[model samples]
Target: MTEALLELKDVYISYLGVEAVRGVSLRVTERDFVTVIGANGAGKSSVFNAISGLVKPAKGEIWFNGERIDRLTPPQIAGRGVIQVPEGRKIFPLLTVKENLMVGAFMQRDKKKIAENFENVYRLFPALKERPTAKGIRLSGGQQQMLAIGRAMMANPKMILLDEPSLGLSPIFCQQLSRQLKALHNEGKTLLLVEQNARMGLSLANYGYVLENGELRKEGTSAQLLNDDEVKRAYLGV
Candidate 1:
């Protein structure tokens, strides 16, 4: 069997002395699209932060490509191709679209590879291609989200951990974002997404884990979770 591309072993996170996450574990295999769905304060972003090495776990381990990475720094983990598109579409407000994308490739040394990544990002987000010089702050909400994803793509990541990609998008933009994400998955990109939009998250991912108050409340194939009565009532508003 193929080893998991990413795994978290009984992880725990704390803020000051307060526990934010408690013994959460999950896995993502190659080419898999996985999602974690929950309400606000469910510790979804905290988990992504731990995976990105922004915040160290107070307990447990994180493994990527069979290597223990819980002890690594943020840059070290990012160097290993685990990139995160953080919540709130944190693109640089003053940077032009192309400039913002180039920031993601700062670690790359190959000039040709950087060019190729630019091409790929533009292709994935034609709106960015059309306004390559526009300041990031000028882009609409959907476009900013696109730029955030594009920036992460510029890093040539093996896996992307996206935190709440659909948060404030209009229904139309959400639909568009969903299609773009699905296209990325089809192209063999491994993704781990966290979202409060339960229906959209579950629909897009093949496998899902539900988080409730910083704990793993449920885990199943997306189809299974979509049909689950408890999940329906609590998350899907069914």
Candidate 2:
């Protein structure tokens, strides 16, 4: 078996005195596409935050590329190429499209590599290429989402943690976003996505885990989850 590129071993997270995640252990092998699906308050984002070092875990360990990362700072984790494309399409409203992408390449010192990253991002997102100088705020919601992923790509991440990437998009845009995500996976970039839209998440992933009330409730290949009656009723609305 391939070694896990990212692993959470009995990870626990709390806010103030309350626990948000309870012993959530999982793994993402290199080049794997994994998704965590759950309802609101299911500790999905908590898991992502812990991995990104936005919040310290109260217990357990997070490892990336064979190194411990739970104790690292957010910037330190990011510097290791574990980039996150956060929810709400958090692009800089004041920055132009190209500038926003440049911000993600902050850690890279190689001009040639940075230039190549820019070229790759533009190729993947022609809409962004068409409006390189447009302010982020001027783009539509879908366009903004594209910019967010493109920006993450600029960092040349080994694994990307995407939180609710399709949250508020229109159906058409959601379909487009799904295609883009598949393309990224095909390009051999490992991904861990946290999404409330279970059907969409499962469809996009090869493997999936279900989180409920701060704990893992179920996990399987995407096909298994899709066929499981409990998951269908609880998440698929079938």
Candidate whose lDDT is highest: 1
What would the TM-scores of all predictions be? 0.99, 0.99
Could you give candidate 2's per-residue lDDT for residues 24-138 as a string of tens digits?
9999999999999999989988899999999999999999999999999999999999999998989999999999999999989999999999998888788999999999999
- Model-by-model lDDT, in order? 0.96, 0.95
Shift of residue 214 alpha carbon in model 1, Å: 0.6
Clashing residue pairs, candidate 1?
none
Count steric clashes of candidate 1.
Answer: 0
lDDT tens per residue, model 1, 1-238: 6689999999999999799999999999999999999999999999999999999999999999989999999999999999999999999999999999999999999999999999988888999999999999999999999999999999999999999999999999999999999998997899999999999999999999999999999999999999999999999999
Clashes of each: 0, 0
